[model samples]
Target: MGRSLDILLFIVCLAIITPTLNANKLESSEYWKEQRPEFDSYWQEKAEIAKQDNHAAYFPDPYAVSGNFTASISEIITLKSSRRNLKGGKGEKCLATNPVDRCWRCDPNWAKNRQKLADCVQGFGRNTRGGKGGPIYVVTDPSDNELLDPKPGTLRHAVTRNGPLWIIFARSMLITLQQELIMTSNKTIDGRGVDVYIANGAGFTIQFVKNIIIHGIKIYNIQVRQGGMIIDSESHFGLRTRSDGDGISIFGSNNIWIDHVSMRNCTDGLIDAIMGSTAITISNSHFTDHNEVMLFGASDSYPEDKIMQITLAFNHFGKRLVQRMPRARFGFIHCVNNDYTHWEMYAIGGSMNPTIISEGNRFIGPENKFIGKDQINAKQITKREYADAKHWSSWQWRSINDEFLNGAFFVNSGPELKNRPFSRKDMIKAKPGSYVGRLTRYSGILVCRVGQPC
Candidate 1:
């Protein structure tokens, strides 16, 4: 009896000592790598600043005029009278003074109205906007079959002299320019049957511009079979940092439209936008082969601007993707009208902020993979990313709730997948392998695996 009592006391002492030893180890633990506190603090401050900026967007300065004013032809003619280089005199022929002909200046009022007049001239000066926004034609790949090495100022030179632009296919040729394309405000890049492509550049980057349109172009094989493209990777010093060189990155712009473009095999998102970019519409495109499929409003600087107001519709999210489709950082983002397949991880992920609207979409996992209610990559996803179950999504907000409450999934089933079940029935029937897919139907819960079925 005494010996047994002594053994129990020893066991109790071990239980107490084990935790004390663990506590000591934790107290003296060395960090795996230095934490980026500076980066974190910088973004945290920017996120606060973004909150202020966002408030301003909703409630702009009441004193400032909402709409722009235009200058009359007479006003421009009157201003041109002061200039030395007018082909005709200032009064009757003042209308024909030709402000653009040479040295011409308009009244001081024109200074306030410069954008309006520039808008008028740029929109209607043979471009035929009929008093609305104009079109700027895309500079097609030169007719010569030779591929031009894209360089600095290529986009500037190609577009500097062009007007209210629209993309025009000068010819059907395989020409690749090795430079980033920049489109300023009031430009429409309509790639109507033209391959004005950049073959060996890093990536195509657009920034700080408005009223832009990118349409109908096949830009692929960008990351050629061997070497990686320059655009596949990029980083910024500001709070909005991630894979900066997405397939197509639109940043710090407003009211932008991107449609009918196909992107694949990029390192980052197929399309990514951040910071004060609003009223954006990305539709009718195909995305695959990247860590992030699409990202909206990264960084903390634009927190006030609320990256919530975006429309992602009618897009095809293809298969063989290892990365999460979207890892939203804040609220006010709407991801809708998309079809996803061959996804192994959570199709949509976000944290911290709220107001994420996800609807009218589909999340189809791998052929042998089924819905296992395991957080997308439960192994890889950090704890901080999940403040609550609402931080994750399956399809619509409703589905997110359903999944959290009842462990439901928005995937396919039945005879079409008879031969290819989530697990290998024969292999697991006798002995369940200790692989990713362990059982034929482990309590009917499906899980994502890397190798052969089960």
Candidate 2:
């Protein structure tokens, strides 16, 4: 009896100490090298590429407004009301309020002209030609029952093909991927007019590739996959380790756009872009019922992530979200025109001298003011040691034209940085936060029939 009691005590003690020990282990570079070797190698490769390309030239001021931009709250409201009444309103052209949405959603024949979405993206990742100028491939099968040899016409087969291709679904599907959907370069997964879903299984992994667009999909109930031999392309079948279970994992890639996606209830993060991924935009998406919603940079120690530039625009950070929308590190993040309805913890957070430009976002704090301490939680170097303070104090985290409701406030930090001056040649201003609801009304995947507006 005494031995059994002792064993129980030992078990309890082990449970208490194991997490702390694991936490310490995770902080070591060696731990990551062994556990996530792919991430480590990818980071190293990106660092080498950054050096060779002198990629510092690509880092633009995230805070700089695009083109000659100007908009008033009343004007945005008027535009939003007009857009809300777009359905069955004859002689009234489709007038999307946001620039990104306006780019593609305006076409009444959007279902037939699906590829037009590749042209509509704005901000940092505007140049992404996702399967543009490529042949269209349709996914006719929905089953993911076979991981080793995915049948032709399956979603798995469509994504694994080499080279540029525009992929569209033949019908609405609920795909539970057997393994991580390893995507190749120059692919566009367009789910317009379809109620396509990825749930109860693995999610997407965009790694070491470029020029991809994932639009109008619902990703939920994602669980980790114990990885194995997975076909990445037609010519390649490689062994993969376990996945982190993100709705979308963007790793060591560039020129990517993820728009109009609705994500929730993932085992890990809803969306995670890590390991020096850059030139990306995540817009017109809705997030709910998740913890650690988004994570941009992988580590604070990896300074090479300074090249990471992402634009988060026109997204709705919706109900029951805890934090990290997103938690950035060592990157240039432009968070604009997002509507934050609820956050248990702070909305945005970062360390490691990341430059975050929050503009025209509406932050509606939770009813419990104590939970929402600060809308923007930035690190202050003054409280740290002299060496750490000097380094962190130089970070440029600024807020402009942001609306804080219900006792919410932004905790600004770092150097006094000015918005880069611009000429009015072709400016575009983000709509006010008051219009966020209307702008992001159709933020998720649409269910449109053929020959109908999507």
Candidate 3:
């Protein structure tokens, strides 16, 4: 009896220490051969900050907005046919339907007043004023040859300059990176006015930084990069290990906004926000032709990700997506007003009981041949890895105002969610799924001119 009790205690102790060990394991690894200032304590600090972030303060409960959601849905259903798809053309007035687009897309002087886009972000990433008060640096060069000391006109130098900068491209250019481009804090890589793509090679690595915005870029066909002695910031250059090949790998960072970027065909996840990365908004983007689309939180064992809060709004999950359209764990995920057009396996799935409040998103299931028609859960959108239903029976996974077509369904579990964690006065409603078609119409990289409306 004593031996069994001892073994149980050991197991419990292992669970407690494992998360911390894994989180800080990078400090001892070859990732940072040149130790960063306060690097050892960085993970712990971010983890605690994530715990301190009050989800109720920013993330609105789907149940709290049900009445508004239902009314909006009915109103949209009445407007035209059930298959109504609204689009914006280059007509007289800018018909910016979604709130995010309406915030800035209508303005004719958008190029002159570029920083105004900084104030338009909503949801958990409200505080992210990325490069708002910074100088605008134009990237004239498209090469990534200088790994130790980047050229002045290149994208590498623009990101690693060590201050707030609104980086824009000189023209439409494709920058194939040699290695994972680690960036500094308070930067915005704005690809407006022209097309800027990071494709055919390595991708981005936002590791242990804060306040970043990446807008209007096309990132696709990301391959693995063998890490080497690379310059990350103006001050620090370290020995980086083998890269994960994600289109955007955000690790232990905070206050990030990825808007209007198109991502597809990555070796790993298209976008993976792991570790204790929080206060993020992935809005107005398009994703397609990927296996694992997104992953939130570091691992199932690492509970420090409980602090991660991300908003996925106004995006389109388009053709040939297999699974993990953000398979999240241990965080508050507000999937609001996005369009999921394809998913071979499952749309949204997780293992460790994530608080996923899906509101007003449109999900179209796999084609008829993929699943048995008679099976009830065959077309189910939610995918929990646990075998026993009892494990996640009480998990707070609710769906409100979500439109599930082509036999797509969501299995909701947990207590009565109408009461909501936060107060009723704090509740804010998103547009119903009927608005998704128009909201995500301009999802990918956009073309912008100097004086004309984008």
Candidate 4:
């Protein structure tokens, strides 16, 4: 009888200790400890450089761009219903649709305060003050069609200028780029009050740069450009390699905010951020008809990508998109309040233990059975591969408050713990999945008149 009592006591102790062990597992991992120091050091160096150059430091105060939502939730819903009935009405007021839009779009004098957009970004890249300290450079010549020596007053010339600059177009223009438009650091290409389209030609390459904002433009129908001698800056001309023709290729850069742009039909990924890039927010944009929409990390084996933290907020993934809304590896991604109207195969797949927190998004699967069935196959393949490697359980992929329509489902895998790997306080609450349509209704390029609200 005494031996039986001792066994019961041991069982009680075991039950109490097991919870403690599980809770401390992530904190005590040697891999995480070793990586923590390197991550801190790299960001510290980048922060110092940003301070020295008087550039916007990455990940500034979250409340810096907070918006006052004047419209109530019921009012927003009624507006959405009214707008849906009208179909193509352009006069609808798009003031308080989302936090990003409400921050700057309500004012009638948006043209006069165009530079105020630099202060209205949220998420990890909130400090991306693109060309705020620089002079405004107006582009008068839309004639870079030859891809030869870019003349003065051209878009190419404005991008290749020496210092920080806010580049604005003189009029509505369709620029058929001759080669990939390589950008420098600290620039804002403001396309408000103009119909600017970069199509039927090359795309953009943002390599080894920082603090850039590309807003209010439409980029589509991009083809591969055989590389040649191109002018990067006024004083520096170099031979560039063949370009892959991504809508916006962000490589080894940081502090970028790409907002209110529309993209489709690129040769490669719509937006590819790789090679240790961090502090990026791709918000208030629209993407459609693209395969491999966004790729966050370069390779699965490159562990340095653990520093890559990007926030994809208030965007719209529209029709005919296949996989990789963003396929991340060894990074953290916050995909919040996006409207995913259609996807062909599957949405949001990754490898090498990336942390993906998908919150309050509306994912409407394809209507046809063929497409929905293909998503199941893709999901199973990813799960089986990761499970076989025995790395699936540790990766933190969570779906919270998401609306899955048309039998769509998110296959989440991770430790089922109350606490997340990252801090939840840093993120703002995303609009509910039901409200995504109203939030992202005005996703694409806006035609802003000088005297009217945009």
- Candidate 3: deviation at residue 381, Å? 0.3
- Clashing residue pairs in candidate 4 are none
lDDT of 4 by residue, 1-454 (tens): 6556655565455445332111111112453444244324434554355434322333333222211111222334455433323211256564557656766776667787788989888776777888888999998887785445678888888888779999899999998888989887889999999999999888887766788999999999887787777776666666665676678887667888999999998877788887677788898899987766888875655676677778887799987676678778777787777888766556887777887877778888675432222312233212213444456766777776788877678877776424533343333344568878877788888878886668
Residues 67-89, candidate 2: write the lDDT tens digits.
21223323444555344554422
Candidate 3 lDDT, 1-454, residue by residue in tens: 6556655565455445332112222213443443343243544554355444433323444334333433343344355334233332344366555666666776768898999999888767767888889999999999999998999999999999988999988899999999989888789999988989899899998877788999999999888787888887787776766776789998878889999999998877789887778888898999988777898875666786777888888899998777777888888887888999998668998878888888889998887441122222337899998546988998888887789899899999877555657554444455667778987888988877776667
Off by over 4 Å in 2: 1-31, 35-95, 369-393, 415-429
Query: lDDT of each model, Cα atoms only?
Result: 0.39, 0.72, 0.76, 0.71
Error of 4 at 193 (Å): 0.9
lDDT of 2: 0.72
lDDT of 1 by residue, 85-182 (tens): 32332321212222221221223232222223222221011121211244433454443221132332234333322245444445544444343344
Listed per model in order, the count of residue pairs whose N, CA or C atoms clash below 3 Å is 26, 4, 0, 0
Clashes of 2: 4
* CA shift of 322, model 2, Å: 0.3
Residue 161, candidate 2: Cα error in Å is 0.7
Candidate 3's TM-score reads 0.82
Candidate 4, TM-score vs. the true structure? Answer: 0.78
In model 1, the worst 10-residue window by lDDT is 61-70
Arrange candidates by TM-score, descending: 3, 2, 4, 1
Error of 3 at 281 (Å): 0.4
Q: How far out, in Å, is residue 429 in model 1? A: 45
